[model samples]
Target: MAYVIAKKKNTDEKPFDYLPKFHTLRDGTEVILDYYDNQDEEETYRILKDIVDDGQSYPQETMETIQEFKDYYLSHDAFVVRQAQTAEVLGAFYIKPNFPGRCSHLSNAGFIVKPSARRKGIARFMAQNYLYMARDLGYKASMFNLVFVNNEGSLKLWRDLGFVEIGRIPNAGNLKGVGFTDAVQFYYDFATLPQKQ
Candidate 1:
């Protein structure tokens, strides 16, 4: 089980450097982190669009072609996790400054894993790695703005990782016939408890 998380660069070989790998409980699958090149705006957006389209996920960011241009064209970073051997992409995530001006000390992240890779700890790894990256990049806090209340797995994972619920939007999301559901907001102060670098 080998893997890595390399910074995105314009190379022909492995796009990501080796980070770490984990195994699935039943089938014994392996996964790793791979940063998305902020330079390849077009290709990266296509990959993100495909994931969102396939998962039918929330907030409809499908129209966001250039994530690098989100925060006054000074956005943070994004990455995708994939298998080393088979080259199977498991998920992707983005870390952006929480706001402009003084609020830029804080950051927010969004993650989506392929359906075939769920329940395998890929998201947990991605989330943990993102936090580590944020800290290394000098961010003071991290937040998740639109975590749907029904997303039990993510809520539990984040909670266990020390994130706390700060607020909830009343009926913020529609889950098919389930009517509207509240979107929970979670926050983590990274400055107080520094992650191991």
Candidate 2:
């Protein structure tokens, strides 16, 4: 009798292999999307700090130092989208498991785009890339844990991208100058979603 052994697979490949290093926006601006690099830490931190300060989308406390921001990025599968020419960090996002143990198959993602970068399709581009990354990372589903109801743009974008409102937490978020608002949870199942050509 002959004995055969199977080879073990390498599971440490880059997570964002499906994404390109350079993507051209609708306005013809070339943007680079990749994992965060230490060299771009300052620029990335600036963008995140601005978002936290804006108080329009993300809910959070202040990041007093760059190290704090860097540590936050390192805690998740973080990526930055930047201007290829000027190397300006336009947007960034992080994807991670929604919970530990059996629920780990479900992933969650958060996004932040600079004020100058908004209304220019960056969010849509980042979201599309995020879904691809999530699928490639072996996540069965993706969810935006907290999409404020007052954020009509995001709610509309997520819906248009095939995400369904799975649940909602009433008065879960306090929008700046707008009192309390509901936080809607959106979900997308990879098996049901059509692959992007």
Candidate 3:
């Protein structure tokens, strides 16, 4: 794929296949969403850990899970995005079939943006982009599971993006330093929303 230079700095660079224009701030800080390559997969492990590793964050299965995801994507489709320059993975999310065979059109996804990048619209960008990608691949909908009820940022983002709160699992996750929190299930129907121009 031809990667476009979404954003640029004084340093030399190449284009990114899927990211949008990189924007520069008044202080000269540039933010770009570059594709997550194999070289960056290891860093993704630590990034995923830092964000989802609440007391309820699942175990070291991340490596295996990511590897499995990579393998699966070899025959399917997957995408991840990271903040350029710092290489500190901003957040990575992808679309995958909910099941094999007849259920392949139904998709599932998970998202995680680094703590520092919160409120910066990275999550929104990822969600928006993934929806288009999913539609292009003929997906019917996107389902997100285990969203912490206390995660106001994501809850609001998904809701604004057209994901509905279909169910809630009581006391599903331990809030690490705090007590347990309910896990809310969300679903996004691609056919229900207008396409981004």
Candidate 4:
């Protein structure tokens, strides 16, 4: 089978030299997106750890140590979003290859927006930046392997951003109280990404 290769980033904490950029959320709040750094590590880990313990979205259930967080998130191209003025981290994400070698052009990403930052459009903003960054890193497409069906907000956001439902897995998410729940897979090709007007 034919495949594509994605440009490799330096195997360091910060893979790309991305300039901090400000974006307005749905409620007109401004947030800055930039590469992950050691300074922001503590706060970001707290956010992700909470989500993992909550058992609603992420697959990994526990992040017991900062090293575990590093091994999982920092191994790839990771970024964080913070409030422009206060510099309070509100969310973070990481883009990594979905497969090895020749299939590395197919990228995958995971996002975490703190509960307090929800409803302000932080996720969408991060997603927009992620798409461009993925393409810039030579990924031809991005695919989300598991999105719980009950996550209406994320489902809506991905669909609105032009991702299509490619497949579904029954009982894919072992949610906290709900037990096994249905999950959907989503896909997007950079080829069809509409140029921002």
lDDT value for model 2? 0.79
Identify the leading candidate in terms of lDDT: 4
Give the whole-model CA lDDT for all candidates, comma-separated: 0.66, 0.79, 0.63, 0.87
TM-score of each: 0.72, 0.86, 0.71, 0.89
Compose the digit string of candidate 2's lDDT tens values, residues 73-184. Answer: 5565778898998988898887777776678788887788888888878889889888878887788999777888888999999999999999999988777787788899
Candidate 2 to truth, TM: 0.86
Ranking of models by lDDT = 4, 2, 1, 3
- Which of 1 and 4 is ahead in lDDT? 4
Greater lDDT among 1 and 2 belongs to: 2
* Model 1 lDDT per residue over 1-197, tens place: 43223332334343223344444433566655666544435544555566545433365634455643343222446677767677566677777676666777788777877676778778787887777777766778897888878778888998989998999999887665566788889999887676464
Deviation from native of the Cα of residue 101 in model 1, angstroms: 1.4
Q: Candidate 1 vs candidate 3: which has greater TM-score? A: 1
Q: Which residue pairs of candidate 4 clash?
A: none
| Decreasing TM-score order of the candidates | 4, 2, 1, 3
Give all candidate RMSDs, comma-separated.
8.0, 8.1, 8.9, 3.7
> Tens-digit lDDT track for model 3 on 25-129?
334446665545666666665556565455444322233466554443322443455555765566776566766667667777666666666667777777777
Which candidate tops TM-score? Answer: 4
Return the TM-score for candidate 1, rounded to 2 decimals: 0.72
